[model samples]
Target: MNYNESLEKLLSLTDSERVSGRGQHTRRYDLTRMRVLLDELGNPHLNTPTVHITGTKGKGSTAALIASVLSSQGYKPGLFTSPHLHTFRERINFDGEPITADEFAALIEDIWPVLTSINHDGSHGFITTFELLTAMAFLHFERKKAGFQIVEVGLGGSLDSTNVVQPQVCVFTSISLDHTAILGDTEEKIARDKSGIIKDGCVVVTSPQQPQVMNVIAQACQDHGTAFVQSSEECTCTLSSADLYGQNFDIVAPWGEFSFRTPLLGAHQLENATTALVTLQVLNELGFTVTSDSFARGFRSVQWPGRLEVLSEDPLLIIDGAHNPHSIGKLKEALHDYFQFRRVVYVLGFSSDKNISAMIQELPYDNAEVVVTRSRHPRSASVETLASEFSRLGVSVKQLDTVNEAVQYAMDLAQPDDLIAVTGSLFVVAEAREFLLNIPPELYPSLDAGMPIR
Candidate 1:
């Protein structure tokens, strides 16, 4: 079968992402099934060293940053992230290129028989969809002889399918309340779950966090006999300048001082950049050769599309995939710091499971014109629901049927100097970005993946 057919086979399984990632029972995340699948695949997870990153936010960017540096330094690092902006291939990349559609089709075909057996036989309690994909990633990395793998946890770290690997370095970006029903409602509990990736002998690096969150991370590292380094404590970043185009900063770490520049906007990215840099230093201590020049080149070259990315300048349109309240707050901060406008129009949509009310409160609304819409994503929150939430905040809200409609309305309403911020879920931002840039949605040659396997 071709790529689309292969994806259909995969999506016709138990997928939590498609169902809003709620109703996640304990049994749904059992790692035994994943372990069994990996063993059947000849334990490909063991073939490569790992850098595992987990957090409510910034994990993807951190993974991208590390992968960029490693690639620039002549290392073949397999990078795995989740909840793609446009396609399933975005979740799996090596040497800065996403796996081609044919490669994906072949991987699925080769593993289908074994994957089916694991799911049907029930000897291992049935592997879930994500577990199967994780297995595929390991197998692909092994096939490629990847020097190291930089993996971002799909959900919480403890029982995430990707947690099967014992990482040499574990990274945590800013932790907050996300995936609350499955992970936890409180920040401390969530921190505990995310900290579960800290295995023995691994070095831990974390962005500056709340005191309580830091406590949980420290205790977890202590329990695992892992070394922990807090990024803000170990390194200081001085932002020389920032604009919608990019930002330039200087970092002072234990090893030395270095200047860095990246097209990734926002203040939170500074934390992510420092966390990545500190982790790379830890990798160097563990005997990976990453020169200062590679660091400079990597920062300049790393591309994390759809995170505070500018798609147009005439109307000052920017899109970010800030789905949760904390991330929305950070998005607000970035807007305030990086751009100026007298009036703003927000093209907003969200997934059904997200805390819409809280996020509405977090999002800035002064002189804000609201256009509510639903993305085509299966879990997209209803336009009516979003409109009501914004109305409750004393904001005048207009309803549009789709992201494309909402973006057009927002553009018509905004002046050249006004900002049109398209955000909420990445799914919505993906649709908006595609429409704005005239790029087709980036599935696997016209395909997609849904469901978790169990």
Candidate 2:
């Protein structure tokens, strides 16, 4: 079968959403079926060294940075992430390229019959689409002879499908209040869930998380007898987020102090870069030597989209996937910290389960105009619902049915110095970016290309 046809067939065979629904029921919290499926595929995950990353916000960026550093260190790395902005193949990468059509075809041919046989029997061995995809990734990376595999948790860590791998190093970026429905609303509860990836004798690395969250991780490390490394105080970096390209004032690390610059704008990204640096340092201490030159080369080349990405030049169209209250708070702070505007225009959309009102409240829109919109997702909250919420907040909102319409409306009101920020859901930001920048979603290869996987 062709690539798209094969993916369609696999997606149709089982409910893809069930893969990410583990947090709903403990009965479904086991990985036996996925393990068996991988065994049938020759247990590819066991063939490669692995790094597992789990966190509320920075997991994607952290995984990308680590994989990039590994590539710079002359290792062929494989990266697997989630919720592709364009194609399903984006979830898997080999040597920094999205799996080709021929590769996807070969992978599906190998796994499809096995999945069919398991489903035909009366066994409770059903695997979700994400699990199947994860299995496919293991098979792909193993076939490509990867030096290392960087895996990002699809959801909260404890029962996430990607947790099946025993990682060489387990890294948690930061714990936040997102996914409260599944992981509980408290920071402690969420921290406990993220700490589930720590195994005995493994090295644990973390950024400067909240005090409560840090305590949870520390307790987990002690309980598991794992070596835990927090961000070094001297590894701090200062960030200057100007309207144009931002400058990262990098401080000295275990290797040494050095400043690096990138197009990534925002203070949160600076923190993320530090988290990646500390994690790499832990990896080095574990005998994986990544030199300062390799680190600098990778840091400058790493590209993580849909996070404070600037798409246009004149009016400065910014895109961020700030779906939760904590991330939105950071987004608001970045907006106020970097640029001053006569009037700001916000094009926002969110999922039905998200804290829409809370996120909207956190947005720094004192003198700004808000345009509410809905993205192309099954769970997208209606524009009217957002309009009503903003109305209750005593903020006038303009309603648009889609991100494209909302963005155009915002641009119409934008002046030369005015700024337009599109945020709320990654789905929304993805759609807005495709429209405003005219980058066809299908043309952007995959999430794997963004990571230097393999």
Per-model TM-score, in order, reads: 0.95, 0.92
**Which residue ranges in model 2 land beyond 4 Å of their true spot?**
13-27, 232-234, 240-243, 441-454
- Winner by lDDT: 1
Q: Candidate 1 — which pairs collide?
A: 14-452, 15-451, 15-452, 128-453, 128-454, 129-452, 129-453
Q: Which candidate gets the maximum TM-score versus the true structure?
A: 1
lDDT digits (tens) for residues 1-454 of candidate 1 = 7888878766655667665443222246688888887888899998898999999999999999999999999898999888787778778898899988888888889888988887678766755657767877888888999989999999899989998888899999999998889889899999999998999989999998899999999999999888989899999998899877899999998899999899999889988999999999999999988999999888889989999999988888999999999999999998888899988899999988889999989977778888999887768889988878877878889999889889998988899779999999898888987798786774422223432111
- Model 1 Cα displacement at 435 (Å)? 0.7
In Å, residue 193's CA in model 1 sits off its true spot by: 0.8
**RMSD list, candidates in order:** 2.8, 4.4
Model 1 lDDT on a 0 to 1 scale: 0.86
- Report the lDDT of model 1 for residue 42: 91
Give the alpha-carbon lDDT of every model.
0.86, 0.79
State the number of backbone clashes in model 2. Answer: 7
